[model samples]
Target: MKHAVTVRNVEARPTAVVAATTTWREFPALWKPMLDEVWACLRAADIHRGCRNVMLYLDDTPRVEVGVELTQPCPLTGNVVSSSLPAGRVAMTVHYGSYAELGAAHDAVIAWCAKENLSRTGVRWEVYGPHDDDPAKVWTEICYQLS
Candidate 1:
């Protein structure tokens, strides 16, 4: 499916996350269990968890933080620690379908940025929407930081 890419400013948000370094292919197996760890930590801490999940990618490495947005800044709890999504301008697009095709959304953003001569900052993230029983109803927002 064709994705419409847009540029916008986003604020830093506090999150409870589990950091990991894994290959792109290996990440699919890690995200769910990682998020589960974060969720358990949040529940034990009596913190409210947001409805969406996020996976923040670092600029310099394969490391990623898979977790949920926090309602407020929180202290470290177990391996689930305090981290914030950097505030900045980003090229964003929402992939409206199965998670299997989410990479196409990222590719769309990459192509859009290149066509517009916009340089990416090497950092990016995916905000996963609530899951659905039907694969066609899933949506994930891909955001790449802009330089």
Candidate 2:
């Protein structure tokens, strides 16, 4: 599929998250439970306010911070802590399909950066769109921070 890759500046946004280090293979199983805890923590802390599921992917070891955006800045609550999407220039694209095909979007960004001779900071993320009844309607915004 064609990916409309673009580079833009994004402002840092605070989140309520649960961070973990796991391989991509293990991520599928781990992420949801971690996010579940984040939701519970948010409910207990009373800070959760957004439906956007933002998963901040960092490093090759595959460290991830999974959570939803917060309505306002908040303090630590058990396992759920405050995190922010770093403010920087990033190569980004929106993936319109199943989450299973999301990697294609990441690959597109990598290829785009290589073609443009751009360097990445080894930080990337997927901001999931609102829920849809059909998987075909799901869209994810993938971004890679530039150095």
Candidate 3:
């Protein structure tokens, strides 16, 4: 996959997330079930979702938070909690295709950072596009914090 990475200052965005811990191999199994709970919480609270679904990876140990952006923070209930996408300089790229193919985008960003001699914050997140059957049309913004 071809990627063009860019460095930009990002603005912090509030999100309603459900945190989960799993290995890389178990991610596919974990996200859908977590997102179901997220949706149910949103529905029960009568909250309209904001932007794309975001999965933020917190560390190499693979702690992840899966949730959608909300216009503003809501009262917390159950496992859904309010969080913010970190702001600051980031190495960013857009990945086009299946979720299974997302690793290439991450690799591309890391390589770009290395080439640019940028320091990493070890924080990464993906903003996913609308559900689609066509892999080519699916869009995901892959971002890694630069520090």
TM-score of each: 0.89, 0.91, 0.90
Give me the overall lDDT of model 1.
0.86
Q: What is candidate 1's lDDT per residue for 88-115, written digit by digit as tens?
A: 9999999999888887999999999999
Model 2, global lDDT: 0.87
TM-score of candidate 1 on Cα atoms, chains taken together: 0.89
Against the true structure, whose TM-score is highest? 2
Against the unseen true structure, what C-alpha lDDT does each candidate score? Answer: 0.86, 0.87, 0.87
In model 2, the runs with Cα more than 4 Å from the true position are 45-49, 73-76
Tens digit per residue, CA lDDT, model 3, 58-79: 9877999998877654676789
lDDT of 2 by residue, 45-95 (tens): 665456478999889899899998776555556788888888889999999
Cα deviation at 9, candidate 3, in Å, is: 0.4
* lDDT assessment of candidate 3: 0.87
